[model samples]
Target: MTLDIVRLLELTGWRAFDVDDRGRVLAGSDESGSMQLVELADGERTDLTALPGAVTGRYLPGERAVVVQHDSDGDERAQLSLLRLDRTGPAELADLEPLVDDPKHVHRLLDVLPGRIVYATNRRNGVDFDVVIRSARSTEEHVLYDGGGLVGEVAVSPDSRYAALTVPAAPALSDQLLLADTMPETRADALRELTDRRAAARHLHLDWLPDASGLIVTSDFGSDRTRIELLEPRSGRRHPLVTSDSCDLSGSLSPDGATLLVQANDDGATRLALHDARTGAHRLDVEPPTDGWCGHPMPAPVWSPDSRFVALSFSGPTAPGDVLLVEAATGRCHPLTFSAAQLTGEDPVEPTAHRIPARDGESIPCFRYAPHEPDSRTAGSAVVIIHGGPESQSVRAFSPIVQALAARGHTVLVPNVRGSTGYGKRWYSADDTRDRLESVADLADLHAWLPTIGVDPDRVALWGGSYGGYMVLAGLAFQSGRWAAGVDIVGISSLESFLRNTAGYRRAHREREYGSLTEDADFLRAASPLNRVSAIAAPLFVIHGANDPRVPLSEAEQVVAAVRDNDLECELHVYQDEGHGLAKRRNRLDAYPKALDFLARHLSG
Candidate 1:
């Protein structure tokens, strides 16, 4: 059965952020049309904030108010606002009291306590972020530490004495932990570096121990795979808490300080288990309804105040999205929300995992979504969907676009080329810096393997957004004859220009992965798809957000202009209200359907 592209795009999902003491969940949902902050309580959802883009929030101590983090359109310059729950009825947008409303700089909420809220901001200078602790009720705020890079994670000590900060290490794809004295009198003695700043490893601060003597951390310091570790900040002592032989592991300590919800990323699928927080001993394995993705977008598996149950968002091939409450002791699971109604009769396709052989003998992990009943008109046609981040992995999560394409009889192949995470550190960093093009080469290998899976080699199109978009263009330009058509969304066409035009704070971080602009100018230019646009053999559809801070709209304009200059079919759609992506539902409903139409017309032989 063919699914309506517009309706598929409109199907929404829920992500649980924080659960209050009263068993109320503060979540981000699109049940109200657009992604908004809503309160889930007593079998009903109360809208907290409404808008086009998704809003994240945390419940204040007493459940009387919430701290909301929202961005304008998709600009990603998030601002923090407080919404009081002392009203008799549902709250409106005007009810939000801005705590930090600066549109120019980015303000991210880290944690919320009784009377204070901690956040990271690039307000001082646009490039470096300073961790700040501000009073929840007043304008009193203090700069806790000025960690010259992005703060990846932060966990306040149990006794509220120190704040463990995760900052980017000197090298790319690595992070270090810094312990800050939250109440220190002298700025000189306020910050103490716990992890080695020069180490080529990544460390994430999950939560503090109940005694405040140590911290729960996930680090890949000595191993290629990340593992749970307990580190003492005072005496510089640390030990492994949890270890996995083949997969990376991470977990969160419960509020009662007894159990740890351990999650293992085994080749893109999650293995949920409960472990002893203190001894790191294996306890019970909590199985979800299906073998799918869980705790995505982070800040999930939230333990209830009494520590009886844990709540996390789950999404599988058939499940659109729902919140699952798992009993800690028995490992029983129950769904708090259901999204199956969104697709009344449609049976979403489940992907089969495969390791396709690459040219270099390296195996590229991929997920293939085959159509249940193939449409003869589009038979043998396939779409290769590339994931962005190059660091992000394409797990078994529900993707409406992928399902819609499959329902339309288009075989969709999602590959985690070379640099995708979840597999290991070596895999993610394999294509970094000077080795960037090696990843694009993986695309060529993927195309060559298309015919082996019954897909027509001449009818496969490339589809991706962001870094994935860059791969789509690179596949067409670098290996022009391999791909039939391409759909690029907010992609980087010119690596040189992208490095030069990207947001100031992001440029330095991105340069670490894409190579230095000043030193590697020649390499950047030679590798850019824009420079070789003349070689592109496929028709192109370029979609971009006008306010995108990362790639910028110029990336789209230049490529489209270049493609059109060659007298090739290049269509461009620029959304003025969006920034990095199609975060808003309405924009997605319009763009994705049109994109599918473009694919249908070009792929239908």
Candidate 2:
């Protein structure tokens, strides 16, 4: 039976929020910014939408409401109001009237302490982050951390004596954490040292010690290894804690700061280890289940509120993801039982792995999800789903989109291709610089290899989002006659244009990956799909978020214009209020139907 897109769209997941320490639930569904607070004791829900703009969220610790002042559709227009949620009622605490009026921007509340709230105002020009210390009693506002370079993960010590700020250089650049005392202008010195050091480290993680005497920083050396170091802010002395050549340690310090838990990969499987904060000694190791591919350890381990048990999402080569809860001290794990009804009603599609030889005779691992029907002889249409990050890998998971497509009598093939991580570091770095063309070749090679695995070659469609979106257009242009239809969502058409208009955080990094726009001008143009738009023959469906910061809306517009100039069968859909990806339930419901219709029209029998 074919899947009903309209009926499935109605079963949307409820917008749920994490319950606070006090058990108060706060969540919003739409862009209207109206936040609803649910009191767990009486099961009573209160609506808080009386503010000027939509309520982004309410802060913790003191239960303060933070609302961004905006017009209809929740567009940022500079004004931000911080209201106090007290027993007396919701009262205005601070009114920030028009800091900088930039359309479709975001003003996020970073931290809220006793008398101040640190926030950041980000526009297209880069994030102008500021530590705004505001008080309701007085009108004094203090600007602490304000400058450039991607600022985030701002943390203030428990005693409020020191503040630690992390500034990410680029996506590829190692992030640096600057620690400073609460005194005025203390962060200025740390920021200057950070600028001068120019740390080329790729991954950096930070956590404050128990007494706030020092900080524990973990930096990944990128060959599937990491080093943990402790830094004393006062003396500037760095102490090396632990170094693992194969295992990647994840998870931060415990809430009580008594112990630090780390998830590491050992012998092609994941194992959780507990470490002593002061001595850096491994105290306990949690052994995962013997079955399945446990080598790919989860990035972060979920610790319980009381720090008694640790929860992790684990999956094997053939099985779907299952949650595992383990005792913190004993390292005993208990797998939670989930029925088909509880997890998913969709039938499981068996995945068969194959090693396809690339252009350079290198074997690229590909996974093919075949239809569950008994009659395998019936040649069915196929969809090639490419994953984003070009650096990320396609793992076994319950994907609603893949299941929906398979239910409609179509085969789905998700290829890891070149540059995808998990296989090895060398395999990932192969697609760097001008090596993106190799990824394009891998797609075409995967298409040719589909027939041996029971998929009809002629009835194939290319589908992807983000970098995958770029691949969709690239496939339609370079291998025009191969696919019947293509779907590109927030993808790039011209690398040159993307380099000029991408988000500030990624501008330098992407230029390094694709090739510097200033130096390799001709090479960037050749790699772009816009230059080869004339070769595209397949029908295309282009979707983009109007306020997308990563790959700007102009990327979609330029591709659609090229398709129109070529007189190709192309349809463009842009959501005005969304950014990067669709966040609203209504937009997602609308997009899936249009996407299915486009693919059915072109590939379905």
Candidate 3:
């Protein structure tokens, strides 16, 4: 059965920001260019079109007002607007200008402090973004940090006094963490340079202490093991917190700033441990469920608002993710209730794990999702969803998109291919430089493995965004006959051009991931989908944010032009005010339907 385009779109929860506090609920809805503020109070619902492009809504602690991040046309550009709502209804509190000038670039409100709001803006210029702190009421704006090498993590202290930013240099060199007073130009650089000479050292994780006096940072100091260090921000005095021999250390402090949680592998099984926040003394060890499918315990321990209860999402090799809420003091966990009926209206589909052997006999892990009913005709058409962060992994989770696709009767396989994290440093490092072809080969192998697993080979399609989008085009061009259709969103077509033209902050880190474009010309050209576009056989749907700083719209344009030149079926949809990913609900709603229509027209049998 062909999927109902309209029904599928409806199934997609295109939600905007909604805040409920003190029995009053304010929701942002799509109403032309302006957002409709739906106020629910005393069983009466009143819709007010007060703000434009309302993306998120937050209720201030004491003010009883709602601040929303909104844009005029529901495009990429968004501004924070304060709204005062009471018995007299909703009124505009403040009309604040956007921190960044580029409407197409991505801007995000980092955190709301005592008197100010911190925001970060990423432009096509590079990875290093402009950090701005603005007054909640006045036009007073302060540019804290700019023109730094690609910034990774930015965090503001709970006291609203200190701000920390991590900057990555070369892979072997130590990264710099900058700590500054939230109010002024009192930015002090804390360089965590390695004492030992290493060629590829990089800062992996960073966290600021609650006291705002120090920070805990994890770094790869020319070894497989990650070293954790606690450093005083003002004195620059560093102390070794923990060091492992084989497994990497990954975790952070609890929200209340009382306990530090750490995750490390013990005999191939990931273990979770809690440590004393101040002295780094081992406090508690929580044993995760031992099941064949349960591979390792994730580091994510969701802290409650008060930090008394810790919620966790755990999964293993064969096990689906199970949400558990644990008492912080006792470490006793209880299963949390997640209504699958409300989200998918059915029990969530659990992934079937398989280890697909790579070209060199190296086993690559993958998860396949198909309709629970084997007799269902919607099973044959498959969408091979590639994940972003060629460096990231596809973990077990309640993904709305993946579940929605499965509900529509299509089989989905998410491959952890090459360059994905979670396996080990060696597995991740293998895909670096020119080894991207192996990642491409891994996709073809999965396509070939589909029929053996009772899936239709001919009705297969490819889809992904960001790095995954690049994989979509790669699969089409290299493994041409395998996929029936392809959807590439903000994917790179030309690696060389992408490296040269990408925003500044991102370009600084490109050398470690893809290698320098100047030094590895041949390898980059071979990796580019644009260079091999003549080999494409499948119909293509390319989507991109026109203002994307990472993989610019040029990548999409070049590939679309090349595919059209070859007379291959291709369509390009560019959101003028979007970046890397679609922010507006309307754009997302519009893009997915068009993509579904394209895939159904080509791949559905």
Candidate 4:
């Protein structure tokens, strides 16, 4: 019988990203296969970007127009296009024109003001991102600051007099806030550190308290967990407003600036609460229905324009993410979406969380899903899917891929290895630079652990995307004889080339996670899979997007070539209309069947 994998893959939903000043929701959904812009208003849903490929969009403040990032296939470099949202009556064709037509470099819109637009681009310095300020009224633009890899998050004052920039301090390398003049006529130094180096290394600028009197930010200085602090940008004064026991704190100050929407992650589950931004007193708790994240547009608690309700995307182990409108005053919750109820398919196999100890005796948390029917393929065969972001943890989010694999009769285990997030800051930073390959070692622990669960050691396959894809390669390279087959989706072949060829916008920060080529080339070379591809004994299914900006096509191309040269079983599938991951439904339908067939042919021996 053919595996009905496509039906399982299609039963997932999206998280809300952008909400304009008018409170209309803009989400990137794969309901139609490709990533299309969706607008949610008055409980009515509309597909805005009905075009081809993936088109991510953000609202331009007053609901005037939307700035969308569209690229050819999966190439990370995108052209900023303007889709007029203020059109009246019968919608004319959105004459999509380039907002800032620099298709060669990544243009990130930081702050959009009435007359000025602040953005960052590496057009000039291919090595570092530079802040560029362009006038909204005209095509004229100028450099705001050329600080090399220092400037990141940008916050503007309500008066439009100044802009607060987050700068990474050297040596200690902590995040510090810096102030810069925004007024065109103002003759200031343009940029100056707003806070001293003694401050926290990281500060998530939440929002400028009403009238821009103070800035409320989440900082971790002198604390184990992040806490909200109000900072007097000009005077360099700071005071704590809210704190957490251990969970990472996030949320924003209300538009009225009276109450703070506080959301903290307790063991990867979000707990929502409201606190007085001024007094730091707890108002009420808006506990999340499930113990999962508040969803995308990561600042947590995305507030509506009126601030009457906070938009939250909550998910569970079984349910895909759905919107929740949590009333700010009473902390009472109302379900804004019934879409999560629409996901109907096979009997869902629930995952049980396990604290399996690795070879080093360090506790590794993972979620294991067992098949209902324990036939030969179901009992003996298994697959381990690694979450990408060596820093990102494998949380119990709504994952159709995991469920689909279990549906196809494979016991699935997702391990939160040494370098995953939601554990703590230390574990999150443990596998940086040279220690990354050790994460591949954690795969060995997973490989050994499978036998204890009745799965044959030889029947287990390894699969992952992005950094997880890198892990898949490392598994087949270093631990060759263990996995039955390896599925690499947009994974890195060489850590060195990834650091060099990745889009300029993501290169520096990515280097922070995976070592820099300038300083850690020797160690990176020793850890790369390209040098060890000769050892891969298992069948390999390599998949990549042609426009993948993060891992790049060259990584997939070279690895496939090297694998084929080794006279081993290898399959390479590239989707010309996808990027990074399989964002389109059509591509998924095409690719997943091939994957299911590949696993069945290799694992059912």
Candidate that scores best on lDDT: 1
TM-score of 4: 0.89
Best by TM-score: 1
User: Residues 1-605, candidate 3, lDDT per residue (tens digit)?
Assistant: 22244333333211223222233444443333334555544545565445434455545434656556655443445556665555364444244333334555656666555556777776535245677777776778877667556555667777766667766645422355666565554234422232322344445556667676767777555466665777677676777677687777766666567777777744234667777777778888765544233344343444543556555545442233344455668666553322222334345577777788766788877878876654244557888998898877787644555656776678888888887766656666677777778888888888878888777899999999999998999998888788899999899898889998886556777766787877888899988888989999888998998777778889999899999998988999999867777756567778887887687677555
lDDT of 4 by residue, 9-73 (tens): 66546666666545567765667766677777877777677665667666666646667677666
Angstrom error of the Cα, residue 324, model 2: value is 10
User: Model 3 off-target regions past 4 Å?
Assistant: 1-108, 117-147, 156-163, 172-205, 211-213, 218-250, 261-339, 343-347, 374-381, 508-512, 575-578, 600-605
Worst 10 residues of 4 by lDDT: 290-299
Q: How many collisions between residues are there in candidate 4?
A: 8
Q: Give me the displacement of residue 238 in model 2, in angstroms.
A: 6.1
What TM-score, over all chains together, does every model reach? 0.97, 0.75, 0.74, 0.89
lDDT of 2 by residue, 324-394 (tens): 55566777766542212333544556566678877678877776777676233324788889888876777
Assess the local accuracy of residue 285 in candidate 4 as a C-alpha lDDT between 0 and 100.
92
Alpha-carbon runs more than 4 Å astray in model 1: 88-90, 290-299
What is the Cα-based TM-score of model 2?
A: 0.75
What is the TM-score ranking, best to worst? 1, 4, 2, 3
Global local distance difference test of model 1: 0.85
Q: Which candidate, 1 or 4, has the higher lDDT?
A: 1
